[model samples]
Target chain A: MTTQQLTQQIRIKKSFLCIGLDVDLTKIPQHLLELEDPIFEFNKAIIDATHDLCISYKPNTAFYEAYGIKGWQSLQKTINYINEKYPEIFTIADAKRGDIGNTSTMYAKAFFQDLNFDSVTVAPYMGKDSVEPFLAFNDKHTIMLALTSNEGAFDFQTLQTNGTRGEAELSGAKELYKQVLETSKTWKNAQNLMYVVGATKAEYFTEIRKIVPDSFLLVPGVGAQGGSLSEVCKYGMNTNIGLLINSSRGIIYASNGTDFAEKAREEALKMQQEMQQILK
Target chain B: MTTQQLTQQIRIKKSFLCIGLDVDLTKIPQHLLELEDPIFEFNKAIIDATHDLCISYKPNTAFYEAYGIKGWQSLQKTINYINEKYPEIFTIADAKRGDIGNTSTMYAKAFFQDLNFDSVTVAPYMGKDSVEPFLAFNDKHTIMLALTSNEGAFDFQTLQTNGTRGEAELSGAKELYKQVLETSKTWKNAQNLMYVVGATKAEYFTEIRKIVPDSFLLVPGVGAQGGSLSEVCKYGMNTNIGLLINSSRGIIYASNGTDFAEKAREEALKMQQEMQQILK
Candidate 1:
């Protein structure tokens, strides 16, 4: 889907929420285990129950990959079901992939061509060539990691840069995350770029918006991760509402019982309602 | 495999050469396509012909994942063949995975427990929590990307840091890669850790060795990417010969004709011979 379609979906649904379908089997209802493809069944019910409540579904591939081929099949089924049932809904393969040139191209093929996700989260550690291949696909988005909402964000990200005056002059001796945002914009087909800026750092949004004011930001870490939606929107929102706030466990695993889907919708409704108010 | 077992293998084989099994169908022989599992057959042939020549096998997961579930199956088969038949060989799943704390644990289980890779490459962009879960797995290795061999390495890996006087004091206002090298050493199970220091940046290894001289380094970009093996060994080698220098396409796709496996063996033998001389 194009950015216009995604923007339209957000408007029509009155929500900018991206429900993360990062399902874990051990956490799901015990009864769902009896199904032939329990993961898919669980996801199917979740999408069925809550598809209208959100604009995007982000499946962190690690959850599906942990189960091996069976998990991949479930992921395939889940995405296929979503595309066929609701093509307007944007999809993200939260597979933080980045590799050398040719290798990165294969990954681009896997997520963009093979799986058909609207976007895939990519690590910027590998630089331009690692990312440019993904961006080469004009329609698919490449959400690069900026300020990750984790304790480790302080490790290398928050560290000030050691660039020479020539390098530092462009972006100042700012944090590494800011540098990633600045440098990425100059790459080929960068118009297709988005960013994964963890919502936990709501304050950083004010600074982030300055770097790429127009690009979409996929904000993870909403409910379970302790990011306030109001603060995120207060600083991060653009004229286009340039954010896709993601909620995973708090929404998908709202309940593990037979009524899990309904309960999930309840949780999603709460988010969608909050989002609608924010949009208004 | 433990570091001790890895050391034993390097010593036993008299070669620190690591063959990267980054197989792609287009690159492999057309004759192999007729087989039920051409990838596995190609890998099996390569392994059978060259197992004794190298100490480790690193199958980049992208090449498998690009083919979808069938590709994942081929990957499973490839790893199983090596583990069952050539138990001494260290296997590196060049999957470059890292996520949030909980999600990272799932990745650790996927690569270390489910897939049973002895080591898996991880991106350090997410910080400590994303990596510690992988480290928590006793005996398994987490090879973090320190300084990659690709052009993208220049983007972030080479950036000088804006460390405080205190941090700069510890590791100096070092480049991002050195900071990664220094910070990773402070993580739990640092002993089980390794770094992916690309051979193309062999000059950086001299600086890298100063941070953590003892930790093993998985150096890619050997042949196909124009990295000199001798230069990597000169600067990076430790008393334990602590470098798994990877040569993927140069060895694996040595030929696409009837003698593909033989040619692959020849390429492997050439590297092994060079490695043996270096060890001597």
Candidate 2:
């Protein structure tokens, strides 16, 4: 989906929330475990319960992949269900994939063409050619990691870089993530780029916004990860509501009883209600 | 498999050659296209033909992921075939995966436990928390990207970083990849760690050896990507013959006809012979 379509959905829903469909069978309701495909069933219920409360669904591939072929099957089912039922909802495959030129194209085809996700998260460690393949697909977004929410983000993302490649604007020195943002803007078909900036580092958004002000930031460290939604929205939002505040365990696993979906909706409703007020 | 077992296999086989099973449909022979599972058939042929010439088989995950479910199935079959038949052969899942702590654990499980790969490649951008989980597995190897073969490697991996976290070595400044090597060594269960250092950057291996002399380096970009065997072996090899030099298109796609497997064996044999001479 285009940014315009995503923004329209956010306006209609009154929430820029992107609910994370990161399912783990052990964490879901005990009753659901008896089902043939517990992961897909859990996701289906959560999506049905909270579709109106959020504008997007971001499924981290790791959760599905851990289950092997059955996991891939569940992922295929979940994505197909989303596209068939809620065509308006923006889907993000938070796969964190990147490789060389041709290999990356295969990945782009896997996520964008085959799976039909509107966007897929990519790691920026491999640089331009690694990312441009995803960006080449018109209107299909590529969310590259800029500053992640994990403590590991500080390991390299925030380290000061001695700028090369004619980066004179930052006075020859800046953080690695900023360099990633600036350098990425110069690549071919860069307009299709979005970024992954962790909500835990809300203060970094102000600086991040300066570099890619119009680009959507898929913020994933909220709620269970201890990132405040208000602080993230305070600095990260643009006129188009270019922030997808993601909540995974906090909302999905709110209650593991039979009313798990209803409880999830309640948790999602709380975030959406706050977002409704914030949108005003 | 443990590093000791891997080294023993390398010594016994008299080859450090690792054949990359990155199968693309269009690239394979025309006859295989008619099969029920062409990808798996193709991989099986290649593995059967060249098992003696190579110490390891590194099937890049992108090639399998591209075809979605069927592709993943092919990957499963291929890995199973290698494990069941050539139990002595070291297996590397060139997945290049990394995420937050718990999530990384899921990915580690996906490649290591579920699929039963001896080793899996991981991207080091996320730092200690992301990678330490993969290292936690016993008898399994985690190969982290150091300096990649692609041009994009120059983009972020080569950028100079102002050292923090009390890294006083190298006068408080070094390239991001070097810092990756140094920092990874400090993580828990680091003995299980290996690295991916591209053969294209043959000169960089000299410095990389200083930081990780004992750890195995999975060097790609040997033939098809224009990297020299002798150059990488000269600078990268340790007392244990610590290098798994990979060649994908150069060997596997050497012939797309009915004699494809024979041609692939011929190509692998050439590399194995060269490696044998280097061993002497």
Candidate 3:
């Protein structure tokens, strides 16, 4: 889906929250085990409970994959359910896939064509050929990884580069993540592209926004990762409310009891309420 | 699979060649199109023809992904065929997937768990958290994209990075990709870690090997992209003949006629002969 459609959805729902379906079998309610596909059963309940409150559904492909073929089947079923029932909601295959040109093209087809996800997260490490293939798809969005929240993010992302020709302007000044953001924007206008900046790294958003003021940002690490929603909204929100704050474990596995769906709804509502205040 | 196991297979087969299964629909012989699954049928024939000539089979996931559900199903069938018939042939899901820990875990499951691939390619753009999840799976290797072949690869990958506080040794010296290679090695002792250094970027291998001496290198761009196999072997080969030189189009789509498998085997045999000379 395009950023324009995503913005309209956020406005219509009065929320910027994107619930993540990183459903783990061991973590879900024991009762779901009885279902033929426990993962899908859990996701269907969660999506049904929290559909109206969120603008997007980010399904972490790993969770479904952990169960082997059953996991992939579950992922397909969950995405199909969302598409069939809540067509308005954006679906993201939270699969950070990037490869060589030919391989990237196939990946684009997998997530965009076969599975039919609105967007898929891409890693920009292999440079343009790997990422541009994903962008080649007309309607699908390619979310590039920028500054992430993890501890190891500081390892190489924040490192400063010097003596580079095209990056001489960013030589002694900005961090590598900032360079990636700026350089990536130059790749196929910021329209079909978005940046993934973690909610935990909210403070960096102000700096990130300066580089690409219009591109949407898919912000993860909110609920279960302990990133504050208020802090992220305060610094990261754009004029169009271009932020997709994802809460996976904190919402999907909100309760291991039989009332898991109700608990998920409650968790989603709390985030939506706060997003409503921020949208105002 | 670990480099040791891959090395053993290479020795047993007397070849270090990795034939890339970049099954393009348009390039496949019209005869195979009559089959129930053309891609799988084509792949099975190719594998059957070249199984004795190569130690590994690298199926660029994009080829399968482009076909969508049918593509993925074809991929499953191909891998299953290899597992059942040619179990010793190493398999690689050339899917450069990298993301935050939670999301990456799901991707690892998709390729390593469900698909049963021996190894999967990954992009290190998101740092340790993105790459670590892929490393979490035992018996599964994470091949990180280090130096790629595309024109845009020089965009950010080669940018210089100044070292931080404790990393004073890397102060104002290393490029971003170099730092990624160094830091990624520290992720899990480099046991299950491999790096993708494109054959076109053979010049960088000398320095790359210094940082990751023991790690396996998945070198693409050899055939279709015009990367020099001789130059790549000269610089990239290690004590373990640590290189998987991939020839996708040059090998698989060598001839689009009824003799496609024979032609594929012939093309792979040519590469294997050259690789043998280098190994000696």
Best by DockQ: 1
Give stretches of model 1 more than 4 Å off: A165-170, B165-171
Pick by DockQ: 2 or 3, better one: 2
Reference-based TM-score of each model: 0.98, 0.98, 0.94
Error of 2 at A81 (Å): 0.6
Instruction: DockQ each candidate and list the results.
Output: 0.70, 0.69, 0.59
In order of DockQ, best first, we have 1, 2, 3
User: Per-residue alpha-carbon lDDT of model 2 for A17-41, expressed as tens digits?
Assistant: 9999888888999999899999999
Scored against the true structure, residue B173 in model 2 reaches a CA lDDT of: 78
Task: Write the residue-wise lDDT of candidate 1 on B1-280 in tens digits.
Answer: 7777788888888989889999999999999999999999999999999999998999999999999999999999999999999988889999999999999999998998888999999999988999999999988999999989998888888887866532444445778888888898899988889999888877878888888899999998888788999999999999988899888899888899989999999999999999889999
Tens-digit per-residue lDDT, A182-268, candidate 1 = 999999999999999998999999999999999999999898999999999999999888999999999988888999999999999
Q: i-RMS values of the candidates, in order?
A: 2.1, 1.9, 2.6
Alpha-carbon interface RMSD of model 1? 2.1
CAPRI tier for the interface of model 1: medium
Candidate 2 has which clashing residue pairs, if any?
none
Candidate 3 residue-wise lDDT at B242: 87
lDDT digits (tens) for residues B1-280 of candidate 3: 5678788877777787888888888889998888899999999999999999988898887787667557778989999999899989889988777766767877887888688999998877767887888888878888888888787688778877666523455634777788888787777636788888888877888999888887888887887787998888788778888888777788888889989889999998888888777777
lDDT of 2 by residue, B82-198 (tens): 999999999999999999999999999999999999999999888889899999997899999888999999888988777653233344778888888998898999999999999
